[model samples]
Target: MQDILIVDGYNVIGAWTELKKLQKNDFELARDFLINKLSEYQAVTGWRVILIFDAYLISGKETKTKKSKIEVIYTKKSEKADQKIEGLIKKLQNVKTRIHVATSDMAEQWAVFSQGALRKPSRELIEEIGQIEKEIKRSTANTHRSSSMTKIQLDDATREKLEQMRRGF
Candidate 1:
């Protein structure tokens, strides 16, 4: 069973400095940025990521969509993201499946722990994502270096000449 990561979208946005700054100018853009980051995190960690945004104050039905292989959920009217996240933890928790909830809410963390799911603070999640991104950069650099090296194809005679030169022949 794959690991699951449930993110409380607004909470994370409030906790993350970059997102908070972006949110001040454009809320939608901040949300989109968060989703994009989570998508990358999901790809790197191979975890099923579900990001929940609260629409409790907005009169509308709940919406769920898939973006870059990650799930984005807007909670229904009168339903908070925390409630939805808890519900998901309850539904997905099992011996073989490891569920993680990311939020800065202490109450939410306790609730998640009670449901047998792991809790990741928003700051911690940010750090984890940063580490993953660094790893990706390093891996990409290594791949580029290797591909460049392989791109230079030498003929058998050229290879033999270089080998003899190296041997001082």
Candidate 2:
């Protein structure tokens, strides 16, 4: 069974301070930042991540794209992200799947919960991402240290030959 995380894009952008600051200057930058962060989270967790952004005010059909192995969805005109998320929960929920919806909206939390999907508040998701990043850094440092300490075993003759080659002998 696989875990799925569905994020409400704007909701999280509003909730996260860094994203909110970027949004004040450039909306696209904020969205891109969120997508990149989510991509990293998806890579670390091995969960299927789907991020939904509201396109309800614009006139167009729903659009879905893949970014860094994660899904990015833009709701169609007149269709809110909340609606699309709920629809996705209904379509994807099953006994073998664990669905988690990330949003700070109370109404949305309740809605997804009632559909048997778990609710992860935006604040919680932010903290989880922070922890994951720290783990990655620690793991990378350990790997580097271990690799640098590794010694390759060589016969005496081979070692002498390598040393001679290094001196251009």
Give the alpha carbon lDDT tens digit for every residue of 8-84 in model 2. Answer: 99999999999999999998899899998898899999999999999956788999999888799999989999999
By lDDT, who's the top model here?
2
- The digit string of per-residue lDDT tens for model 1 on 1-169 reads 7799999999999999999999999989999998888988988889999999999657989999998887999999889999999899878888889999999999999999988999999999999988988999999999999988887788999999999999999
Which regions in candidate 2 have their CA more than 4 angstroms from the true location? 151-169
Worst 10 residues of 2 by lDDT: 55-64
lDDT of all predictions, in order shown? 0.92, 0.94
TM-score of every candidate relative to the true structure: 0.86, 0.88
Among all candidates shown, the one with the greatest TM-score: 2
Q: List the residue pairs that clash in candidate 2.
A: none
TM-score for predicted model 2 compared with the true structure: 0.88
